[model samples]
Target chain A: MGEFELIRRYFASAACAAGAEGVALGIGDDCALLAPAPGEQLAVSTDTLVAGVHFPEVCDPFLLGQRALAVSASDLAAMGATPLAFTLALTLPTADAAWLEGFARGLNRMAHNCGLALVGGDTTRGPLSMTVTVFGRVPAGQALTRAGAQVGDLLCVGGVVGEAGGALELVLGRQQVAAEIAEPLLARYWSPQPQLAFGQALRGKATAALDVSDGLLADCGHISRASGVALVIESERLPASAALETLLGAERALQQKLGAGDDYVLAFTLPPRHLAELQAQWPQMAVVGRAEAGEGVRVLDARGQDITPRQGGYLHFME
Target chain B: MGEFELIRRYFASAACAAGAEGVALGIGDDCALLAPAPGEQLAVSTDTLVAGVHFPEVCDPFLLGQRALAVSASDLAAMGATPLAFTLALTLPTADAAWLEGFARGLNRMAHNCGLALVGGDTTRGPLSMTVTVFGRVPAGQALTRAGAQVGDLLCVGGVVGEAGGALELVLGRQQVAAEIAEPLLARYWSPQPQLAFGQALRGKATAALDVSDGLLADCGHISRASGVALVIESERLPASAALETLLGAERALQQKLGAGDDYVLAFTLPPRHLAELQAQWPQMAVVGRAEAGEGVRVLDARGQDITPRQGGYLHFME
Candidate 1:
């Protein structure tokens, strides 16, 4: 079989999903067809991961595949859209069957978790890279956007932060940590669990929502700017991971928590009235701060004093 | 502003288009939203072009940008879907403001021409590469796929072929063509004009359709296998560009037309009764062959004898 036919044979079953109601057609076509339900809109996002840049050059292909899909699906989660389908454009330096099998295994695992079906894509020969564009369906006018935060809205995060960045330091050999601690951190970095369910649940509850990929501080700025309000983020309530705190000290963990990227956790705003109910439903959700009537983002210490850092998150091409 | 913000600024206005009616959101969010009209389904496709592989390491960024969108948009055309939105995932070695400006200019030109809005994407640091995922809308059950060809169906092409491959040979310095012949061939390679209008017109009338990216013979095989039939292609009916013939002669041009790839034209099958009307409307369209009962593909010359090449088009990771 030709390269295209080989891909079709291998990925046809890989694209099958129990939750693929939105996919009218999958794989082996010029374009895959998707039918959104009545009064629903399609939400789409694209993310590319390159070798030696998004991850280590010689890292496990399985992890790379999982991480690629997770990052793209996180955008769908942030938008409160029901997972539907995704297209993967993979560039390989060589056609290694073993590598492809491992990658497909990881991709299938993540697809199963996210309820996303692989619909269309092409595999080409180039420097190793993978670009996944995920699609989801959301009711018209109900998509969680960055422009909905209001004054007095409560700021919350789905989970802890800085674990990925701390793990990245260890993987890059810039830091040392015991294997016991490093294992979970690296897993968090390599295979993040996107808050798809929490995001879907927050649809009617969240005033604004976004996945914290570019650190809490920077991503919070997105909500602030888009909503034309200011975010008051409390450092004490930043929800730093225990692994990060143990690897780096508490003070350094705070720095990483506020400045690192690739968290893929949901950060959203809820009304004061809905806070208790949501918190009761999701015990791990952390109330980090509140939205105020202002512009930009303000970082507050435990004493409620301004202590914003100079840099917020990792900016590609610039950093 | 950071890289993402910079991209937003550079491409926001560029994304504006006449055919953006289906795009509910264009860029700047976690995911761009698209709401197709009721009774319409979305057609999605993804294609990636890598530097030194898809193109030279240092070609004009403007052409690279144009080619990227054109190639992807062609898939939408093949599905008979109206242009809607596209997401770009660009990876570059470094951030060059001038290069970005030129690239955006070219991208904007094609977006306007194709009526495709740039809904979303992100840029990362890596070897130069671009992945564009295009979305379009087609009425339910009206999409022309490769699995609909039948016996006696006339195989046709929307335009001439092999111009791009011949141009590729020139660009790679494997063949030398004079400026008069070289310019048009190179233009075909660098900036293919997708047959969007023709494709849309063929929607309900054609039995099966696909954009000819992998040359006529190879792409013809796709329709044959998918439809569980056979195709009899007349070599004499193959559309060869005047520039290609002038540069490589009749025999060599036929080889290039039959075996070379990168021609973003449309190859499709239609009933014999509808042939005259379509041919009258599109003067460039060529009735090249016929679908028959059997399997695989058979090539015939003017004398109606089998002379199929041992190979078809370029296969990535192999050639």
Candidate 2:
């Protein structure tokens, strides 16, 4: 079969095997038609993960596929949009059937997890890379953004941070730990969960929000700049998994928590009262910091001493 | 500057320079939020053009930008969707300032031309490629689809065909022609206009439709397979421009008309009554054939003898 036929049969049609909601038409048309309910908005995001650059060239295809969809879908989570569908633009050096099947399986799994139906996409021959454009539906005026934070808002994370960064150090051989400590960390790096439900629950509660793909400090900086407020993160309150602490000791683990990337946890700003109310339902949302009437990010030790690092995130080109 | 910063400056923010409506939040957010008006469904399509496969590696960046967006937008046109917004995923091998400027200009100009606002996108470093995902609004259940064509419907093309195919010959140094012949053909190839207005006009009229990127004969085959009907085209009814004829003899031009790709015209099915009515409004829609009871596509000579060709469309991987 031709590559187009291969993609149509295995990838495109398989994406809809379990059926999809909000799609008027899917898979077999020039364009997929999506019917979001009246008074709802569509949340869209695109992310490209290049082989060798974004991940190791020899990584498992299944994990790669899962990571790719997860990365893009996290944007919808950040926006408090419920996943509707996604389009995959895949560039491959060759149509390796085994790799394609593994990738398809991985994509299928992730799509099911995130409720993203494969709507439409294009496949081309080139270096191996995948670009996923995700679409979600959010009620009008209810989507979260980084520009809505205000002074006196509690800066909270949906869950623990920096496990992915810790995983990266192990995977790249920059550091090592026992298999027990490494397993969960690697899982966090390879298949980070997008906090879709928490984001939806935040709807009108969180003043501003974003998924923490960059380190916690760096992503909070985005909230700071966009919302025109300062974020003061309390060092003692930084959420770290026991695995991270056991793997790297407290100080180094704290560095990973502060400066490393790809956590996919949500860092959000909300009034203290709202945080208290939401924390009652979602106990994992820890208040690590607060938004203030200033600019940029400031870190304070347990005693409120200045402890901000020079660099807060990864920049691919600059690196 | 880092890759993200550079993209924020040149590509991402530039997407919103003209201000896109229906987009509640655009660049600099995790996801772009778009609000389609009530009763409208979102039409989404994605197309990727890879260097050395879809286009030459050293082509003009500006024209490449225009061509890339035009190609994907054609799908929306085929679906009779009104242009809404688009996201770009650009992967490049380097960060040349001039090339980026030229590309952004081309993208800006084409987005304006097609009325597609750039809402969000990503920029990555890799082997050069571009993926554009476009969104448009079509009233629920009113979209034109390949499965909607019925037997006895008149098959019409939005405009002339084969110009881009002829131009590709000169572009790849496979052929040469006079400046006059090359000018129009090259323009057609470099910046083919998506028939957005014509498509919107055909809404509630055309039974089925698709953009003719893979040559008219090939795209018609798609409608045939999809609609469970046959498409019969008369050789004499094929539309070829004077430039196409001048570039190649009438016989060669006719072959290109049937076999070559990238015309970006619309081939649609319209009932005789609707055909007549739409013709009164859009004279450029030339009736070249009709749908009949069968499967696949058939071509006939002016005298009505079967002249079915061996190949239908250009498949990138197969080729």
Give TM per candidate. 0.97, 0.96
Point out where model 1 deviates above 4 Å.
A9-12, A17-19, B16-19
Report the Cα lDDT for residue A283, model 1: 88
- C-alpha-based local distance difference test score of model 1: 0.88
lDDT of each: 0.88, 0.86
Q: Give the per-residue lDDT digits (tens) of candidate 1, residues B158-213.
A: 98988888899888999886799999999999899989999999988899999888
Candidate 2 reaches a DockQ of 0.73
First chain of candidate 1, TM-score? 0.96
Clashing pairs in 2: none
The interface root-mean-square deviation of each model, in the order shown, is 1.4, 1.6
Model 2, span B48-127: residue lDDT tens: 99999889988899999899999989999999999988989899888888999888888878888998888888888889
Docking tier of model 1: it is medium
Which residue pairs in model 1 clash with each other? B27-B119
The local lDDT score (0 to 100) that residue B157 gets in candidate 2 is: 91
